[model samples]
Target chain A: MVAASSTKSISVTLRVWRQSGPKELGQFKDYSAKDLNPNMSFLEMLDVVNDELTARGEEPIAFAHDCREGICGTCSLTINGKPHGPGKGIATCQTYMRSFHDGDIIVVEPFRAAAFPLIKDLVVDRTSFDKIMQAGGFITARAGSAPEANGLPVPKGDADRAMDAAQCIGCGACVAACKNASAMLFVSAKVGHLGLLPQGQAERDRRVLAMVNTMDEEGFGNCTNQYECSAACPKTISHDFIARLNRDYLSASLRSAFRPEAASTGGGGA
Target chain B: MNLVGSFFRSSIGRKILMAVTGVILIGFVIGHLVGNLQIFSHPDHINGYAQFLHQLGPLLWVARIGLIVAVVVHIWAATVLTLENKAARGSNYGFKHTIQATLASRAMRWTGYIVLAFLIYHLAHFTLGAAQSATFKDNLKSYVLTADYRVAGFPVVNAGTKVADVYSMVILGFQSPIVAVFYIIAVGLLSLHLLHGIDSLFQTLGLRSNKWSGCLRKVAIVFCLAYFVGNLAIPGAVLAGKLSPQSAKISAPAQR
Candidate 1:
């Protein structure tokens, strides 16, 4: 966290939601802060506010953080109804104050999705995402005994497709942006990544079917071709991955109907 | 086990429910259109069809009960899944680009709810005989005379008894331009709902394959268009006066 510099001066009002715990009701508390640098990152601006609160013998706001860099994806905030602020392809940490003009009244609130329960202040529990991933995300590769790097020669197209799906960081941004709260994009990315890989062939069919089943069991909405999730993803995961996921699922369903054994073993490989 | 929770919460569960319910709904629509086409036939044919349905009595109740269960499960699952999805997101995204999504896809939930409401209103107004008149009251003499006035092997009027004033009700209801417009809008909304719902059902159930997804999408488009066209015909014919008010008086006893 960077300290506030006295060289530059600006004033802004922040309406932030404050809650002690999940069970406790939360309300927005207003704070007036001044002398903020335009180049400072959004989180740094928050640091200034926290510093002032601590100096005044007030309890500083508790928010999630780890890598101040965007890669960690822990920072979740809805600044003026926009996830991670107004910047495109950037997390809250990467969002600089320069994106805002002077006298901008920002409404900073925690993510409001039901799956992500608020922990404290702006932090939320995104464990539902972890559960969805754990259900069928990994290939059946055993560790310790290293296989040959070229043991499986994957086609360039398949490799590219897998990488595209792998880019998703489980940021929950897709869920936030979706009106139906459909996590098809997130689940589809995971399903598509493994389904396209030769190494994942051992459980490809079962994986997609099981993962999608688990996703729905978790009470996620059915994806209705809303591309909001993809657009909102900080990683910019494509909706095409979802289309691929749909393809895999449909084939798996048909195969299961007639050839259950083959579907269980996973069919076709590069 | 938590049947409702499982149906809504799991992706496969949602897909299964969506597919099963969607297919059932489509079946109902097709069957309904087939029965409705009797209007173009001799009035006795449509009246006889309605009477046959009415004669089912207890069987009709059973089917209605089954349909109600399916509908409840479907709607409940959809709502639960939607709520859970909303909960998963940490926050809302700002500055959504219009180029990335189709209006039909974006407004799926809204359209679905609107269509559901419209369906209920339609059933209440037409089928249940709860909206206008409680009974069929067509002039039998007029119907017989009209039926006798056959042109090109088609009965113009085949009024039987003064059972129910369904014909006048339909004509009167549709005569109000607002009501006709509402029906037209409702059909459009239903099409939008079907377009999104069908493709989504396949995705949810893990039945989508790359080789066949395109084909499935095309099927969905055709199905939606057909549904829209089939439903639009009734109101269209009514507005055009091709379906006379006297002809509309044909009604069978309301089952249940």
Candidate 2:
């Protein structure tokens, strides 16, 4: 972590949620962060405060973070009712102290969603996403010699759409931001990315069925088109993919209904 | 599981139903507006149209039943999806701000319920003659009768039983300021409902793309506004005294 330069130091107060475990009731605890550098990243400010708490023999605030440049998506925080802070198209770690005023009381809490049970202060278990991914977020290409880069002549439109869907980092900001705690955006991203690719076409029907079933089994809420998920997404993934997912799921199910063997045979890809 | 059963059980499936039913209902709205727009013509134009509909016999009943089924399914699916969404939220935010949602999008459920209530009231007032509000009953009573009204081509005008005089019934119905105001409010809400619904239906059906989204949204807005203006014109004209059948010469032989 970079040290705060003395020239442009600032002061602020953070109202952070503190919880020891998943079963414990979390409450807001105020911490005064003095001499914070406006140029420092949001997480660095927290780090400085945590150092002070440790020196005072207090329990340091715990928050999840990795690859602090915003790609890891491990840093999940709800700042003032917004997922990933106030910055658009960026993760919580990308938020800078300059966005705040001196003495501003910043309220920081973990992502709030039924599917994302709180693990500690500003940390929640997002493994439900992992479980859904494990169900069917892959193609069944064998681990062999690499294929030629341009072996598949995929249409540019499909390729671009696939890439757009591929941008999801499974951060759960979408679930956090949604009113219904729905995972449609996340699920759609996964479903769409695979379904759009040529290699993924073989098992597309089975992939959608398994992934959607897993999503429901994970106890996530239904999507009602409030669209807060896409709005809150750090990656700015479009909600248009959700519609694609819906269309695919419907057609896949109908196809299965008419040809059960197609679904049964395609399950091998999982 | 059966495809239909599984479809209803899934969230996206339910949305598909909402989109499909919404499209069906929109078709009904356009058909209804066109049918009602005939009221702008001479009394014979509208009354003859009503007579022609009545002459459809069993086919009219089938169409009516189909419309009722479409409406019921649309409402039922929308209600279930909304309730499920509410239950999913679990907890409300302490401080919330909507970034991308519009007023029409946010007010979809509220407007939908209002439109549903208006539908019931409209049917009772116009279809079943059960709306006992003084203005509606008075309008029905004072309606200028057409000669030799028949049900299925048989004249059955018993005492206290009135002939079907749709032209005057509609004209006098809107003569009530309260009724006119209610109709305006309902249609306004309907436009709001449609504004979001039309765009969302395209989205739900996966027909929306970056290239077409803006164009489709503009189309939806234009359609909703036009429908609102066209439907509202009936009551507006009635209140403005432009559609008064009594003022028009009834001597002009009622066109068949």
Candidate 3:
């Protein structure tokens, strides 16, 4: 997509949420981005507004961001009730100011969910996800010479599915968009990425059980099959992974129930 | 911890419970519809069928108890999950936009409540005889046996009996336009609920696949619609005076 000349810059108003800290009572503060370049990304427009606020002896807005490109998934904001703005399959940083009309009031707020406590302004502490990851998001592989990739001979279909689940960026967009604040999509993606691979077979059962248990402990809600998470996901992760997660968890529970020894055995060779 | 306690506490486990119980209830629904469709047959046929069921005695009660348990479990799980989901989203979005949910899926809770209410009212009107309309119970109480009934020229020994004659009750119960309309509306909602629910149940039970998801959804929709139309035709036929109390007896003459 080509951007127009900077001379065609348009002015817009932003109702941005402001908060000093996690416990602070946040409120939307109005700011103007006058003569902003139409080609400027959403973050650039925010930068312009923050610069103006600083110049005017006012504290600039605090928001989380990195890798102005879309990949990092660090830029989290609910623009006009949409995660990563109105565009499909694009993150916040990838959203151009041209998507908005001149003089439009764009409401920018943090991803609102109990699990994601606000740090300041649009930045929420997503460490809860990190906690979930710490629970069982790893596979134990012995330290040795790297094995031949083709030796495993993973089915192409399984690999493709695993790759689809591997695309998750931990953005918390799913939680933000979900009416239930469900972490099912995120957890399933993480579980599927490893569970679908032969290397992850050592602790596949334990991984799903541990991660799902941790997810509940973190106070995230359940998946009600609303499909909002998949729809709002910038990575385009399919909700089918959640069903797969449930299947894995169910079978794991049953196996653990009937054959306790099998579930407790140490990591076996592939 | 006991396996049962842990199962109910987890979200996915609870969903699985809901799905399993839902399948049981749906099975009952199809059975009930098939039995009720027998109303189109001779009065003796439906009345004899009801008598046969009553003869099962303890077995019939066992099935009833099982259905009650399934219904209770399904409703309990749904309520618990819905409340948890509500609390999860403590703060509402100032401007909400739904990207993928359908009207039926979005209004699941409402339809669930409606279906529950209809179920209770239905029990009173038919099963319990508590809220039997004027036409149903009164007409059944005053029903006069005109002749000895026989099916296929074979003697039905217990025919022309009046012990809990469900045939007359159904025909007379639907005579009132209000009662018929309510049943129609309730069945309509039942269809809507099933449209989203059947597919969702398969997904919850981990029976979903990329190759079969679309096909499963289509099957759910078609089945729900067929169920709705089949049930609707009953009350509709009654309201249209096509399946009245007399039609059952009038359709076929008494055979010795």
Candidate 4:
């Protein structure tokens, strides 16, 4: 419990998933991580293992990461059977050695989903998210340059909700955490973020429809409302956005069916 | 896109179908429970209720067919969704640990299958009289309608008319301890199913929000518990001899 005790080094055995290629057979490979600082990040522990592996002329583990601070959404390890390791609202890079005991055996694997193909050891293709974003996670309005701060008076409540939803980093933890591998939480975050704003209202219906269509086409499964996605989310996104999505999709589908073809185009600026 | 076409094509749309169908099935469960509770009343009262239902004739068939459709659709949507969810997970994880999933949420498909089996057996035993002829169709009995037999005090026919004794049929049907135990187990599973399914239905339909989520789960627990006890009371009363072909006015919750 003292600061001096926190400085004590720890050792652990890691059972990491290792695959040579996307099509290769992968299995768990055990490595001993010894003399590690309890404050060392999980990725840093992997770096130590890689260093030892390179010295022994063994292939180094291939893991994906960028920002060690957890903002880039680039860290995608499923440590100890959970995305982003043992903590809440933090990415894998943010997971520290102190969370695990000294003699613990940590198992790490990459996120798994039909839509996200595994590329190498501890890295999977997350381009499916990009495709979903391309579908309708944007607006067509050209409000060039910053308008007067008061010109587009968005309600405080709507502005706050939009900001909350916009915090989503699109790391695919929602899918990884879900029993169904559902991307509803991720898709809902994007849809809810934009659909809550004035500029976003111009294509609100189209945005939800197109994003959902793309999400399904990518082969992600349907949500059963178990909310594992929210529990697993690194950004701590709420599943409430999913309810907002269902409402949007329902109204959109109904409106699209009833709207005349000529006026189907949603005029800009609500 | 065409409404019907899009409704079935999209995953969210299919979930909407599931939620809507779930609503119909839950309504039927509540209605069936209420109607069956009348068995505790005077023999003439329950016999009169059954007679009034039989008199419905074509209308009864319509309601029955509608309920069958709801059941079929609910099961079908669940099957499709389960398969799709399994496929989406792609490969099983080597190290598995559930963080926050409830027992009712995890056991949904299993409880659902058992409940489905219970439904089939129930219909065979009581509705069609196919499961046990001695306890059902061959057990001959009748109740003579008195002035009190008038449904809601509305006179329909002669007061002395005799009607088939459904009261005894139910009494004899649950006489076997095996049947009683099976009813208890099945109804218990059904209560568990509703505990999760009803709350999930609200979320799927966009009816559950952060403000209502906690209260919603508590409400579901209370309702499921009461429904389970209501169902448990019937067979419990029968097995304890509180109700028989010749007796009535049993202890209410004590038998349960």
Chain B TM-score of model 3, please?
0.88
Superposition error at B83 for model 2 (Å): 2.4
Q: What's the distance in Å from true for residue A146, model 1?
A: 7.0
DockQ of each: 0.24, 0.51, 0.63, 0.77
lDDT of 1 by residue, B2-75 (tens): 34544444455555676688777767777887777666655555554554566569998988887787788778
Tens-digit lDDT track of model 3 for B172-224 = 88888888898999999989998888878888888787779999988988999
Task: Say which docking band candidate 3 falls in.
Answer: medium
lDDT by residue for model 2 over B1-256, one digit each (tens)?
5698766787777788888888888998998899889788655445655666777799999989988888888888888877776765654555576767778988988998889889998988887777744434334433333444345676533233333557777877788889888999999999999999998888888777667888988998999999999989999988986666443434533422
Let me know the DockQ for model 1.
0.24
Q: What is the descending DockQ order? A: 4, 3, 2, 1
- Native contacts retained, all candidates in order: 0.46, 0.53, 0.61, 0.72
The order of the candidates by TM-score, greatest first, is 4, 3, 2, 1
What lDDT is reached at residue A149 by model 4? 87
Judged by DockQ cut-offs, the docking class of candidate 1 is acceptable
Q: A1-270, model 2: which lDDT tens digit per residue?
A: 123333466798899988898888778889999988788889999999999999999989889899988888899888888888888888988888877778788888888777788787778889999999988998777848878979888899899989988989899999988877899999999999989888899999888988988887777887767688999998889988988888898888889888734556564343
Model 2 chain A is weakest, by summed lDDT over 10 consecutive residues, at A1-10
Model 3 ranges with Cα > 4 A deviation: A1-8, A143-145, A262-270, B133-139, B142-162, B247-256
Best candidate according to DockQ: 4
Q: Which stretches of candidate 2 lie over 4 Å from their true place?
A: A1-8, A56-58, A260-270, B133-163, B245-256
Q: List runs of model 4 lying over 4 Å from the truth.
A: A1-5, A263-270, B137-139, B148-158, B247-256
